[model samples]
Target: MGLLHRFANPGRFLRLAARLQPWTNALALVLTGWGLIWGLFFAPADWQQGDAVRIMYVHVPAAWLASAGYVALAVCSVLSLVWRHPLADLAAAEIGPVGAAVTAVCLASGSLWGKPMWGAWWVWDARLTSVLVLFFLYVGHIALLRAFDEPQRGYRAGAILALVGAIDLPIIKFSVQWWNTLHQPDSITLTGAPTMSTSMLWPLLISALGFSFGFAAIVLARLRAAVMEQRLRVLLLSRGNAAAGAPS
Candidate 1:
């Protein structure tokens, strides 16, 4: 508990994040590129769906990150409200739009993949509807945070919304199992075996990992920018005040 607070300072976090960003960026680029090439060309096509299944490498990662990002935002919001950690608030705020973007990608990619498989572009399936709602929640979170003149008020509102919106996560995760749906059940699970063979699975795993790291790199960079902007604004405001108080 005591050690965790040591990194609560924005300066220390900024230094740590700066040191880590380059490695993460390079890794994201390398791994994602490798996964794309491997999945598209090297991996065997699906016996049923053919090459269209290759789209899973992209769609699955986007969908995974979209949900994971919101969970992160909610946890950060909890820390912000309970501990009043400024960095937590900043992280949550930055995650909102990124999550939304990924969710949109997931939906778009899924629709594209579904058109041939399902003979339709979309259906109001449980999983799809819930993910769509999650996207909307992210957008609302971003908008609410920017709606107020006082930044703290906006943060408070956004935090509450994030916490409340967390109810959707479990529903999204369980939707295919709990109800009749056009969406398929889990292809991979922890307790059971993967439905896919090694050739098909490796590229998907690599893509997912690369995208996850990419998300972290982007978020850390955004957090650093927000911290810098805040510091700059404070410095400028202080200078303006000092100049106003000085002799003409």
Candidate 2:
């Protein structure tokens, strides 16, 4: 709580994020570029799917970000609702568009992968449907954040929507198990060893890490810009008021 409040100060966050941004950007580029090259050109092809399995490297990371990004947004929502921190609100606002884009990537890659393996571009499989719902939830959160005339009201409303929409995350994770879906059960699990061979697993892991770092880099950059913009607005408003109060 003490730590949260300390970083919740916009100036403090800006300083910290500024220091972290360049490093994150560099790491994201190096790692993602390396992972994509390794996955696409060097990783052993799946016996079953052949080169088509390469898409997993992209799809898996986007899927991970789609859910993980929403979890971050929900945490921001909690901070806003419980503490009414404007920084939390700003963070949540920045997360929405990025989250939505990642989710779209997840959906598009999944569709492309499916068309090759499943003979169709899309299926109403349980996991696929749940992920689609997650995308819509992101869209709704973004919409609510801008719907109100007052920014505070918008933040509060968006926060509530984010909290409620969090129910979809669990559903997305378990959808394949709960229903007889076209999607397969998870290849990787916390309790069980990965079903995928290490040759493939290593590249996938690297790709996911790269995407995670990239996502963090983007959100931090946007949050810093938002804080600066808010400060500029406040400065301008104060100047306007001061001018009005002074003699002509």
Which candidate should be chosen as best, given lDDT against the real structure?
2
Scanning candidate 1 in windows of ten residues, the lowest lDDT window is 1-10
Candidate 1 residue-wise lDDT at 131: 96
Question: Cα deviation in Å at residue 203, candidate 1?
Answer: 0.7
Candidate 1: tens digits of C-alpha lDDT, residues 109-166: 9999999999889988899999999999999999999999999999999999999999
Best by TM-score: 2
Per-residue lDDT for 84-150 in model 2, tens only? 7768999999999999999999999999999999999999988999999999999999999889899
lDDT of 2: 0.94
Candidate 1: pairs in clash: none
Q: Which residue segments of model 1 deviate by more than 4 Å?
A: 1-3
Score every model by TM-score: 0.97, 0.98
Candidate 1 vs. truth: CA RMSD? 1.0
The backbone clash count of each candidate, in order, is 0, 0
